[model samples]
Target: MSIRAARERGRRETFARLERKYRAGEYEEVEAEARALAAASRRHSRRRRPLPQWQARVLATGVAVAHGRGTEVLPELEALIDELEPVDPEAHVLRLIVRNNRVTVLNGQERYEDAETEALGILRDVTRLAHLTPLWRMELSALGALAVALCGQDRHEEAEAIARGNLPRAAEPALAGLHAVLVRSLNGQGRHEEALAEARRDPPHQDRRDSGLLDLVTAEALHGLGRRGEAEAAVRRALADCERHLHPAHPRIREARTLLGRVTGEGPGD
Candidate 1:
């Protein structure tokens, strides 16, 4: 098998094991194994991607997720900036993109403040790339998404400035999707009313019935607006849809059940 394929398989197994432990109520074991896997991946990636530091940083995430520490991969993420700097001028900054989703997940799982603070620092420095690379447009779009993560952490003023200052050349409407996430970030910070207003501003791009992830986010936004009844209904609908339409092992389904438990005040394992 290819190296990528082998690495991917390891990650898939880790997620499956994590789900089983979550159901079994094994939280301590869950946290430990997650930490170990993350550590090992960092060591492996360092040796593998010595030049482009971003790729090395991104590799650790795959390792973290594979070991079921997907929710707490920040220490590894901190290495992104070092890789981004004059550390390697030849690095493909635009292609160092998947890390964007790791930042996005950090916002969702309650690490918003940390994710936001760090991402802004990167935006400030990536200006170095804006005038030099052929993929300025792609990198700009990525920076916009990262800005969204920062914004959703209740850094609206910062998020707006980050997006406006850097997004003039981006092709994708990444900021629009981020606005949806901001709805939750605001809700987390006791800005529920504002979050509700933003949630209503656009038809969400992530409302597909077959994807539990979209449903969970929609449910959280709804729940935040004192629409708990609708959130419950949405979670049930997502679970039903996935059980019927998607693979039983799909990641979205696992996340939906976890979020549903949090929303309904009863764990899905019940």
Candidate 2:
């Protein structure tokens, strides 16, 4: 095979390994590996040439955000967005994905209005790419983030409307996340019964990660309804699922623990 073909094969293999490590909740290791890959790829290319492998750099940025370094990574994400701007057909979708990550980071930082604005733009951009089936995931993700931003701003009713309106179109993998948002929106409105009912209406979850979130939300709804025993059970299930599927320090685990404390009249530190 030609040198170019061999290099492409090696790049794909490296990316596959990085993705697996990222998914396994090894963020620190994945971040280090991705950064090393990006630096090496850039050095291998001529000084004025674009890095032969952009995905590694993007992955590193994402891993940084995952590490709760959102403030630190925002500038990097912006630079990546500029670098990834449509030099190729695939680059546009990747650019939008990076933008989505920025919105997520802003939301994580509680910058609701900023996240809302970013998510709206992403929605418009992704809608224009609807012809590409794979790109539809970006649209769903942006919608989810928009709902979250609205919730953050205490606009729960609007969040509920958006989530309910999009439920039918949310692919199976995204259904549980949207449903979790819908439940939180309902709980925010003090509609505990509705929230509990909504949680029960969830389609079967294929991934434990998704079900764990629903469990946490279901506990909240139950707590709001004065079902302390049920709430404790749900929160315990959520804690177990999250502990197994998520990073040790993931926010979901902390949220579940806090709710458990509420249910049992014990402090979160316990």
Candidate 3:
């Protein structure tokens, strides 16, 4: 192989390994590993090798997010996105990824209008670049982010329409997020029965992250239906699952706690 091809292969392999570790919930480990890689890449850039720095930055940003650093990373990601011009296919794809990351962080920070606007822009680009088959997954991810943003803003009907239209086509990795949006949006619209029915249609999720999210929405639907005891039970389970599986600072953990308070009527809001 050419020298450039060999270097690219090595980088791709390293990134794939990091991706696997991140998915397995080894957040601290991934952070350390990615940081080390980023440092090395920076050194290479100084020597005129100019390795792709965005990959490391994206991984590190993901780690920060797991630790509930949405507010911290928001501006950094924006700056990085600005630095990345769509001058070529590689740069274009990297910019899209960073933009999507920004949208996700905005949603986590409860800046729903901004997230919605960013996601809409991302969707426009993804559609315009539809010839890139690999971008299909990014398109789904952006759509999911947009749906969540809409739900956050209480635009339930629009969110529900987006979820329902996309859920059937979502890949396995994107299923839980889109499903959560759908359930939450239904509950927002006061369609508790329909929301509960839809929640039940999902097979039991083995991953705690997925289960915890579904549990939260189920609790909301149950609470709306005046099933107080059941709602409390579901919310408590959701809180436990989130506490066990998510980062201490994860927005979902806070969300579960808030819902718990509402269900019990003994915590902060109540």
| TM-score (C-alpha, index-matched) for candidate 2 | 0.79
Candidate 2's error at 215, in angstroms? 1.9
Tens-place lDDT per residue, model 1, 112-163, is 6665654555455456665765545445545655655665455666655554
lDDT (0 to 1) per candidate: 0.54, 0.80, 0.82
Ranking by TM-score: 3, 2, 1
Comparing 1 with 3 on lDDT, the higher-scoring candidate is 3
TM-score of predicted structure 3: 0.91
Ten residues in a row with the worst lDDT in model 1? 204-213
* Most accurate candidate by lDDT: 3
TM-score of each: 0.48, 0.79, 0.91
Q: Write the per-residue lDDT of candidate 3 for residues 75-136, one digit (tens) a residue.
A: 88888787776866677787898888888888888999999999999999888777754687
- Over 4 Å off, model 3: 46-51, 204-211, 267-270
RMSD to truth, every model? 10.3, 3.8, 2.2
Candidate that scores best on TM-score: 3
Q: Alpha carbon lDDT of residue 145, candidate 1?
A: 53
